[model samples]
Target: MVTFEYAPAPESRAVVDIKSSYGLFIGGEFTDPADGASFKSINPANEEVLADIAQAGVTDVDRAVAAARKAFSQTWSKMSGRDRGKYLFRIARIIQERARELAVLESIDNGKPIRESRDVDIPLVAAHFFYYAGWADKLEYAGYGVDPRPHGVAGQIIPWNFPMLMLAWKIAPALATGNTVVLKPAETTPLTALLFAEICQQADLPPGVVNILTGAGETGRLLVEHPDVDKVAFTGSTEVGKAIARSVAGTSKKATLELGGKAANIVFDDAPLDQAVEGIVNGIFFNQGHVCCAGSRLLVQESVYDDVLARLKRRLATLRVGDPLDKNTDVGAINSAEQLTRIRELSEVGEAEGAERWSPECVLPERGFWFAPTVFTGVSQAHRIAREEIFGPVLSVLTFRTPAEAVEKANNTPYGLSAGVWTDKGSRILWMSQQLRAGVVWANTFNKFDPTSPFGGYKESGYGREGGRHGLGAYLVPSERSGR
Candidate 1:
């Protein structure tokens, strides 16, 4: 037997300077809230305190909304579309310039591997802004009619999984369409958003064009329910998405929600065994499986099920699970203790439901929340693990006899966020893509994202798209109005 040893290659934490405390960013300035309650955001990798974040109350939400409205009416709305494009272009350049620092800050606060933040998240954040910036001065040619109008003030609430990226998804399109925004980032990962406020300042963006409020669910609720807000955009749990839908019902507020998923990755016998195994791993284990569109369910053709499982187990053994700042680390810590608890509880239910659980022989850190990459075999549609979104480094494996069976099983879930199909047959890929009811379908690939592609979900996974030209519709109203 031979063993290989490796040295730790941790990135420098000094790249980002943490403030002792942060205030709400409203009207282009950071201000203390009337209600002084605050929360601390900690690094999930080691449970180290990162910074203190303000908790926004109803009064604070009101102030932020007022600022957004004022910016919309007095400054941003009056700005020329071509000049608006210039501001967005400046923001994109600033993000590119500070990309490394933002990547480090994102990894520390979000508990994702530095490689992902540096390579995938931060770069795409800049790309989203650049892509939308081009559309600011060309909305008439965007197929939305002669003169689409911007919604006044958008209230956007984002999740912690991909903080900076999600912020870009919401704010970029809203700004491109001439809408001012009040964005409330998730409480767990609010640091990068505050940093983004600083970036806005660096770009010399007009005051009140973007307001960031950091707080818990109540803060998000107050912002979403604010009557003065013209639009509400959210990316989180399906239950909360429903709550927002209800809150905005029978009102003038428009909403776009990107919610939960239990996407199925279907593998046929024709798929290259090694490549299929890699896709399975990448689909479920990326970001500690915190992704809403993660392929949590694996459906394999029965003819090659045993071979696929063997190869998958072998690949799982090589995955390094540890400090997120380590460049070589494959899987990082769970986002929070609460999310870790949810993952563990669901995994326990899987065991109790007669499914077999397996994990790699990897050691976890002592102090922080962690879960080894896990897979459940013999998972049936009736099992909780197979049906629900674990939202962690957990996967459920099920088998099917034919392509039709795979398609049926894949679409059985209430979530239609994303799905993956792996096979060499071109015709079969197209056929399966048509059968699966997911918003984003990957053929022979998994977990791929680009700024030009529109991404969202169907059914209970929530409504509306978040990327590409389609995203502009969420912030614009049709030029021709129907009589009420």
Candidate 2:
């Protein structure tokens, strides 16, 4: 048996005062759901029940939509974009001021490493708000049209992987474009969104401008299908995203989906092996491989296969896997029981399909959901590990002979979210970028994101862009840019 030390979670100073049953945030206040039912939010690290959050049913979704509609028509939509910019600026500053508290809450609720939450997640959340804040009053210069008007109300549903950051992605641009919003945080990671509701209160944003209703799949369905919601934005599994697309078919309600990906990181024989190794590690294992654009498939040139695999195994052995709150921990717990099951099942399929599996000889924590940093060798393009999005710390290695072969194998997926290339030749990098079909291509790097750059996907990875000027499209009315 492997013994591991488990530390108690730090106490929070922010008013965790919301009842075990948290109501919907409507009109600048936390109000009870119309049906008054609630669901439990669990801590995946130890499977403990954190709190019961209000489950918004169809009636509650209608009520939330009505509140958002009222704000849009009476107050928010009427406000000048410059004035709306002030509110976003305030929210950004508040996020910066309360960064520590939010980071802690996010890590506790989402099971991501605290070091990541404090450094990467929270900073990026603030950065996203700050980035979009500058654009609120600059919509005219954004090339959307002469007078870009807000799309009355937006209904957004974000996943559990990056709670606070996703909230910022959904809320910031919507607010920047002068739209009111009713956003749904993933059922498991509702705390940060609820905390954000308090942040909005501190910023004194107008009532009904932003409302949060926390619940499971049914609640999400209600939000997406509600007749009054002007637009719907979702980030999750591709299956769910396609369902939403079909649900919104023939309807004028605007929708954008940021779905799943099984990205490929290609390393050529001429590449710097050390740098490629680092990129591979950060690409697949960062955020415990919970990222949508995780480079789960690593395609390496056959000439350097043995050397690269040896180095990769050695590096993975040194990674710390333990308490999410620990600053030294490199890999954290799996997001949930369901996610772990899926990862294990796919990994088993990889083994049964005759691919060789490898793992570091390290012990994992006993309490939380855990998976060893895994790698599969001799993987063919048809292998499940190479095809499906494991969404865990599992890397599938496929050897290719030439640059053309690498690109062909890398682009052999329904997902086109992201791809990575590691080669010393600049021409090869440019060539691979053009051929890869993914939205974001990292040459000599992997998994790097910026607030100013646009990101989304092609094919089953879903549609539209999330950041930069492209993001403004989701919040603007069609007439604003449609005709002269």
Candidate 3:
């Protein structure tokens, strides 16, 4: 056997100019937090302090919501759809112009690989704005009738995992549907959203149309509970989603929550082992498994379970894991110390409960938060690792005797966000897609997404969809059920 090593090829951080301190973005401008309280945004890769980020308080949230409502009533709602779409189109173009900058900043603050930030996240972010821009002028044909009104003053909060991409998911649709937004990016990764505030200015977007408030959980609660806000959109944990649901209950506020997931990647004996192995690795390791729809559980048919597991480990060995800026790095640093702690705790529980844990021979960086890509064999259906959403690069291998068993185990979890199928039989793919209780099913692939397809979860995974025409309803008033 032979192995090859490559020289270092890191992306240039010079493309991004980080300021020493920052303020909240409201009414298309930056302002200091009301209480003068702030926190540092640290790079998880090296524990480097990126910048001092202001923490928005209750008054800030109130101001942002007021700004959005003013924009909705005075300026945005009166504008022609085509004109609003022109702004979306302009924003999309500017995103491309500053794509490299956003990618580098995203990697710096969020600790995802530079490759993913540049290629996957940024491109998709632009596509979302472009796709919804077309829909902006064509809402009459959107099946929501000739004049589908928007729920003014959308209040959105996004997670730290995929900062720019999640912002695009929340803001693009809401804006396209004629709504004004007051959004809160996660405290740790608010840099890109602030950068996006600059983009909004670059596009000459109307004042008060888009406001960004960066803060922690209390700030999020204050924004969601703001009486003037008409819609709430959140992407985070299931517990928080439940609380948001409770907060909005009986209120006129329409809410959409995209929460946690424990997706099952099912591989049949008849499937091509080589392709299945590649898919399995991609399923669990993409974005370091921070994806809500990540296929964390591998439900292989009993006949070829051992063979598939061996192939998966061999493939994992080829993965590069360090230096997020390095062009060749496959896996990057975890988003934060807190998230890394959660992953370690869940993995330890998997080991304590008698599962065989294995990791590739990978040396981790000492300064930053890092976790080696892991696989746990002999994982039971009831195991914590199998059931809980371990939002890291960890895979749990479980076996099923029959196709029915595979479907049964896959649908057993509270999360019905997504599932994967790898089988040679076309009929089996069709049947499994129908049987799996998931919002989205990927055949022969995992973690694939596009702006044209709607994505969300069911049950404990939360409700409502994002993307495509269906996603438009989340920001609409009395949204039609049949055509939508």
CA lDDT of each prediction against the hidden true structure: 0.94, 0.88, 0.93
Candidate 2 C-alpha lDDT tens digits along 1-484: 9866545554453623434667788778998877788888877788878888888887778878888999989998888878888888899999999888888777777788888888898999988888898998888877678787887889999999998888988999999998899999998789999999999999999889999988898888888888888899999999999999999999888999999999999999999999999999999999999999999999999999999999999899888887777677788889899899999999999999999999998788778799999999999999989999999999999999998899899999999999999999999999999999898999999988788988899999999899888898788864545464
lDDT of 3: 0.93
Candidate number with greatest lDDT = 1
Query: How many clashes (backbone atoms < 3 Å, residues ≥3 apart in a chain or on different chains) does model 2 have?
Result: 1
- Stretches of candidate 1 above 4 Å error? 481-484
Q: Write the per-residue lDDT of candidate 1 for residues 1-484, one digit (tens) a residue.
A: 9988678999998989989999999999999988798999999999999888999998999999999999999999889889999999999999999999999999999899999999999999999999999999998876677888899999999999999999999999999999999999999999999999999999999999999999999999999889899999999999999999999999989999999999999999999889989999999999999999998999999999999999999999999999999999999989999999999999999999999999999999998889999999989999999888889999999999988899899999999999999999999999998999999999998999988899999999999999998999999886773110
Root mean square deviation (Cα) for candidate 3: 1.2
Answer with 1 or 2, whichever has the higher TM-score.
Answer: 1
Q: Cα-based RMSD of the predictions, in order?
A: 1.4, 2.7, 1.2
Q: Considering summed lDDT, which 10 consecutive residues are worst modelled in model 3?
A: 475-484
| Candidate 3: stretches off by over 4 Å | 478-484
Residue pairs with clashing backbones, model 1 = none
lDDT of each residue in 1-484, candidate 3, tens digit only: 8878978999999999999999999998999999999999999999999999999998899888889999999999889889999999999999999999999999999888999999999999999999999999888777786678888999999998889999999999999999999999999999999999999999999999999998899999999999999999999999999999999999988999999999999999999889888888888898999999999999999999879977888899999999999999999999999999999999999999999999999999999999999999999988999999999999999999999999999999999999999999999999999999899999998889999999998889899999998998888774454454
Which has the higher lDDT value, candidate number 2 or candidate number 3?
3
Estimate the TM-score of every prediction: 0.99, 0.95, 0.98
lDDT of 3 at 254: 92
lDDT of 3 at 223: 92
